[model samples]
Target: MSADLGWWGVPLAILAGTLRGSAPFLFVSLGECLTEKSGKINLGLEGSLLMGAMSAYAISYLTGSPWTGVIVAGIAGMALGGIHGWLAQQPRVNDVAVGIAMIIFGSGLAFFLGKPFIQPVAPQLPSIAFGSWSSSPQLESALRVSPLFILGVLIAPLMQWFFRSTRWGLLVRAVGDSPDAARAMGISIFKVRLLSIMVGSALAGVGGAFLSLYYPGSWTERISSGQGLMAVALVIFARWNPMQCLYASLLFGGAQAIGPALQSVGVDAYYYLFNASPYILTLLIMIITCSPKRTLTGVPGALGQTQE
Candidate 1:
């Protein structure tokens, strides 16, 4: 797969990597988007990601069903999210502090529980072979896409529409923008925020499943690699828009794919540097988006504010 394509392999590999790599980002960013849209930030999603990866791998190995693993992963994430939401709602408790604690707790729990399943082989999720029409094996392999990625793509637009046209979406927006106003309008701010966090966490868990069951395809202590943490920045870069999240995810995915893609074409001198591209890109994006002079459009008004 590495030697056959010469320079042409770079673009193809990037395309393939984008499809494969973006799913996790897409799911995580979307999850974070929902949470933030409801005026909450889930810094603990990294923990949820690791927990999901461990849970999915263990379940898949035991049940021989990848889909089951995905479900369990989502549940695990929801549980963590629920905990974060509940704790953050306490009077005088800071959500950011709660989020940080969840990160530690979730990741520690996952690492402890995952120790037993580290060596087990698990069933992998299936991919759609879009490259079947190609005569070249490399091309064929490159075009194989994950069903989860497709689902994320479809959900992005649906989320956009939901936010724009649905009454429930309006309620969520109202809560995020002004809890006092939402309360005045008879909305349960607590319930709305709690549900949003759980659903968002569930999506993050599915992203973790994608990592263990599809791409890297294994249970490991380091499976998440900060993708969950980076997702916060991604959501900001996307301006809380689901469709923009998709594009940003693809960009991040392509950046991630560059290192291995270059190595495949025999460019090894700068392999480590290439692999650092995603992190570097992340830093650049945060710097650009977090500029003090620029007002961030679409940021939830109540985001990061202390609740009375």
Candidate 2:
């Protein structure tokens, strides 16, 4: 039932790829946004992602349930976040340096532990057949959607609302903007930041789980491909706005799909070039969004600074 739509299929393929590709970006960006909102930067999320992927894949292989793997992966990410948070709180410690160290630790740990899982198969996440109404088998198959993608879309608006309407959200913003003011107001800066980092790390882990358990659906050493780092740039580009993160994710997702879309259209030349599109696009986004003349509009105050 494999029918080709000729050159017309490229757009469809890209569209499908976008849906699949955007989920991880959306999740990771959202996680980083949360962490930055609390005035902390976690560069170690790249490691958290790898750890999450390996944990999820391994757990699923053992437990016979992908959801369990997802939950465990989140916990693993939280542990990493907790470690980073604790280390950052130590006297004279540098948050960025600790984060870099954590990244190495996380990656090394995952690599060592994940070795056993590389060859095993895990249960695949279930997808909704959104293309049920379509007669074209290719279109139908292309439209098969993961529930996680839908969840990410739903979470964006909620995050926006949470920041605008909730007391805790205001507290996080206050802490990020001015620690002195937050302390004067009787808010606990340490608690807020610690919790934020842990929650953000958990979200990143869930994103990792989505990568291994759902989309590409496997465990591997190179599974992340720097998606976590790309997310840092994405948060900056989005100006730390949750809603904007959704849009940015889609843009990145489309960029990632370009290579495969070209292949679908029989443009096999320079396949490596097409595959490099995502990284190249990341570079372009960073260059366009960052500037020397003006202060960034939405950067959290005290970001990357050691908290007292």
Candidate 3:
């Protein structure tokens, strides 16, 4: 029994790590879930997320209020999403290419704006007290999970329920599966997609704010750490389901924490590979879940059409 209990500890430790590590991925996954469900892909999520991180820190540092930064970050994200949506509505613009371009622009923008913020310690987010539950340092450390993690978990179920049970969700589904048919049914497909993109961007902005206010409050080029790109792939892995994204993001998080664990144990050889784990997993999940046939059949029919 003692041995069995000791073995059980490993999973519990991983679970804690998963909760801590997956919080960011969860935000990105949730945002992507909203975007994809509306039948449009917002690849610029990387740029939006980074810009949010930079913007949040800068705003909070100046104002001394973390909440203010969070709000501004959301607005910035909405702006990015709106721009992407607006451009996508144009006849000649390619969404994929536009996303890549935004990534470059966002990167430059963050660096340019974050120059002054690199040294200052920005405002910190308030945390839930997991510390009260235990005395052992290990246990206490494990308990220090982010509130955002909890929120992300809660969001998954709520989003799932909303989409399956609400009128607005039905409209979103209508837009994704068949815009023409939805139009025939009196739903405005363009309006649904536009709304979804804005919502998705706002969520993605929140995800970026999570980085600045929570985990690592310092601004750097690598803060977002390619999380945006991988999250784009996570949408496919989650199969258009927000609830599934919660689980999938946690799985990716667990995988990500492995290398750090190794480094702690004095094994440094696998660090780079561990750093790459999330993207690798994201890519694999995409390949496994994406079916060319099914995408054509199930995806929003008006995906590439001009929204005029």
Candidate 4:
């Protein structure tokens, strides 16, 4: 039930908005963080996310299980990353160009596969109920968030530890910063990048699945138009640290929720502009966080490399 939340209920609304908005980015940023950590940027994440959305929705509808759909979507995204890695390992096509091509292919593929399932309702994820603690109806509704949101929150710190403390994490950083150096030290740049992309793509796919099987339900040609793109930017803003990605993603998520929250409270004069707030905030965060000075600390050194 929607809360009778009045003007003072802004905090509750923001809380609700943060959960709703952040789930998608949580998935995408986590994925991009891995890819960038390996010193490669997979702009094709857009395609991967869209493809995952379609694949997840179709599978969920067919199988009557959202979790199963999520798994299949992740596999599809990894396959896409595998193709990107193989092509990138070749000299003929640039990674950027391949990524762009992948975007087109992914979008088209999502559209094509998604056509038949557009109207079919698929199995959706159940929300976590933390409402028992609250006595007020408004409070209960406010707490109706999902377990996946909590899952995303937990992944962030785990990623930070993996990056800062693990042997593989050091290897990933070493490869990103100096492939030649890493090569001399017995690390494989190609393998690292390939694995990173696959992991990132898989997360992106899961993120897409969240959109269709949880937040909105069902699917469409443009269900994930720019969410994937913004998430890549979020990874940069978070500086390749998974813990930071969590906070940054939630903030972006809050910005998106603001537009709707305002509209819901009978404020619509600037609703259209509110719709664009999230993207604008994303741009601003990237511009501020990606300055050369900040990037040195947060950005991967191995990004956009040319093998010699």
Candidate 5:
């Protein structure tokens, strides 16, 4: 692919990388989006992502079924999220503080438990070859897409619809926009927030599964590279909109692909620097979107607010 297209390979590789790399971002951002929409923030998804990766890899190795690994990973993430949710509900407790603790605890637990599975091989999730019709190997390789990625794509619109049209969605929105109003209407704020956090964390775990079972296809301590944390910034960038999260995730993925895409075309002079594009892009987005003078357009009103 690189030799055939020369400089053109950069864009093609980036497009391919966008499809491959964006899955994790997409899942994490969507998960975070759901959590934020229900009036909570979960910083522990970073830990969840790592735990999911480790658990998925270990489970796949043991069970010889990648799907089972994915399920276990989601369960692992849900456990961590459940802990955060329960602790946050305690009197005088801060959800953000609980989230931070979860990050430490989850990461440490994953690191401790994942040690033995580090060297084991696991079955990978299969891909659908979108480019099978093409004779060129590079094109075919570039177009080989993951089922999880496809699922993420479908989920974006579904989530958008869910938030717009469903009764449960309205309840979530009401809880996020004004907890007092939701409470006045007899909604159980604790249950809604807990469920949102758990569901979101499960999605984050699935994202982690994608990391181990698909792209890079291996278990590593640093596989996530802070993508879980970045999902928070991405949610803000997307204004808590599920469909917009998909676009923002793809942009991040493309940025991440720049370095390798360039390297594939023999442009390695600033490879490491290019690899930092996603982080740099994240920093820039945060700066631009989080300015005090610039009101965030679609932020949930109850976001970051402590439950009384």
Candidate 6:
């Protein structure tokens, strides 16, 4: 019932966009989930993400390997996460304050280092063309799925299992739910929390790499576009479950695709307004789904506490 594409095609386009766009959300939220589950919070992941994007792009451009860039991005994120973890171990240091400082430092460092990379071209992550099986060229183009997305999907279940069955997962849960119990078991709180934060930061870095090296496929000052911060809210919305994070990320991705989907169907009025629809939708969903009662059920008990 349309010119370029039929009415049914619009939804399909949105579906494609959702899958493609959800990769960053999935990875970021998973990282946030991991961090929160370990009784620590890192608000500075936004900075880590930005820094990762910058480093990924710069490295890819310099080394001619996007995968290398992704690896470097993970390392960059881990470096920032390690710093946050180490500072949190200091006497009288607040995790939130340290996280904020890391954000400022990482962002400033990234901006300074990323100046020359703004205009340079970098290698992009490759995609698998699932649309090859389709008869439609549009479908084929839309079906070009990134391997990173598939990896994220796989990671969700793995994370869920990790928390449910693995010894490390039990330790993280113990540290999160009851620091005293973890200590009683002779577990080092500093080591567990620090390791969790580092892993979370590394995941976030890979998420950032997905942004610059895959989706928009470029380096810039604002490549992250606050995806890391949004992921914090998403983690809250998911109640800290990794599997829930996968679905929630898809919802967010679909919300983001609404604007572009409308434009593709010749409904481009107030494009900026449409662009902001994803945030609005995500907020509404969070408000609708979040229960005031039992609000803290899934929250880690020891989160944000300064242990003496």
In order, the Cα lDDT scores of the candidates are: 0.90, 0.88, 0.77, 0.82, 0.89, 0.87
Distance from true position, residue 218, model 2, in Å? 0.4
Clashing residue pairs in candidate 1 are none
**Which sections of candidate 5 miss by over 4 Å?**
1-3, 279-294
List the lowest-lDDT window of 10 residues for candidate 2: 299-308
Candidate scoring better on TM-score of 1 and 4? 1
Q: What is the lDDT of residue 292 in candidate 5?
A: 77
What TM-score, over all chains together, does every model reach? 0.94, 0.94, 0.87, 0.92, 0.94, 0.94
Superposed on all Cα atoms, the candidates' RMSDs to the truth, in angstroms, are 1.9, 1.9, 3.9, 2.2, 2.0, 2.1
**Which structure among the candidates has the greatest lDDT?**
1
Task: Please identify which of the two predictions, 3 or 4, would achieve the higher TM-score against the true structure.
Answer: 4
- CA lDDT for candidate 6: 0.87
TM-score of 6: 0.94
For lDDT, candidate 4 versus 5, the one ahead is 5
Question: Tens digit of lDDT per residue, candidate 2, span 1-308?
Answer: 76769887877877788788888888888988999999889888888888999999999999999999989999999999999888887777888898899889999999999999999899978999999999998788779889988998998999899888999999999989898999999998889999999988888888889999988889889998888888877898899999999998988887787888788788999999988887787678778877898888888897877854
Worst 10 residues of 6 by lDDT: 1-10
TM-score of 5: 0.94
Model 1 spans with C-alpha error above 4 angstroms: 1-3, 280-294
TM-score, candidate 1, is 0.94
In lDDT terms, how accurate is model 3? 0.77
Return the lDDT, model 2, position 63.
Answer: 92
Better of 3 and 6 by lDDT: 6
Q: In candidate 2, how many Å is residue 132 off?
A: 1.0
Model 3, stretches more than 4 Å misplaced? 1-13, 268-276, 279-308
